[model samples]
Target: MRQIQAIALVLILGGLGYALWVLYSQPPLQLSAGQADHVSTQTAPLAPVKAATDVTLSAINTLPAPTTTADAPDLTPVSRLPEVNDEETYIPPISPSVAAPAYHGDLSDHQAYLVHQSAQITQLKQDYIAAVDKKVARLESLLEKGIRHQLPAEQLQEARDKIQGLRAMQAQLRHELAQ
Candidate 1:
């Protein structure tokens, strides 16, 4: 059944394609007699050649010469890919190894501000890391002594959970800062 359906579909498509080809591949539509007459009358028929003498060598010589630069159209550049030459030398670019720029001019306002903000951000990050480290150390110390100091089991567990949370937050912060 599927094979029959597939064959039917192929036949239908082929028939449609053939129909389209027959429609389009034929000559342009026929015009009315009046329209045909109007078109034929409008177009001047070429004169019958009596001899090749109409196109003489002297007539060719009398024709105006091709225009030079001044009269010609502005030669706009046509953007096309450069043709590769097999014989041309291909010098590999130098790797960015240590050559510093000669211009040591004063920094623009934006550049200076960027440098200042970067330093400020670095300092702020350092301050944050120091604070987190202190908190983590304090928590660890507390956890170590929680049982000896007669802290309740629930309280110790809560403290332990808090330390884990803080450590995770610290790790996340570090990851963000690294990025």
Candidate 2:
């Protein structure tokens, strides 16, 4: 073991020494003042490359330059728009047709409508609660199955989290109902 370790240490040192020697032996790179940061594509025409690909690329086709005619409409330069002051701005009153219709029903009629709306809202809450309960039940069953069949921790955790969220939602709904 000691011999192997000594051999490995010597090899590592020798490799490092050889690398340093090679690096120091190389000539330092120097850039001339006129040297460009990027290679110019103009000097090397792309025609040869196109020929290699068996695609003949002649002079690039360019769109014809636009020509102005004496018949063209005269275009006037845009001038600064007149400054608008807040006080000068007038907003017309909302049209009667666009305004909300005024409540013309009697007090008792309005009360009865309010009661009906409240009942509808309560019914919606109850329906949502029932749906949440169903989901919680399904998730609980899945959790039980996961535990029984030794499902992956991720799937089990996901089922548990969903059950928790549904329960929290149910609790919130119950709280609101109590209020």
Candidate maximizing TM-score: 2
Which residue pairs in candidate 1 collide? Answer: none
lDDT by residue for model 1 over 9-82, one digit each (tens)?
99999999999999999999799999999788779685687788776444775467889989999765656655
Stretches of candidate 1 exceeding 4 Å from the true structure: 1-111
lDDT of 1: 0.75
Model 2: runs farther than 4 Å from truth?
A: 1-112
Computed on alpha carbons, the lDDT of every model, listed in order, comes to: 0.75, 0.75
The number of the candidate with the highest lDDT is 1
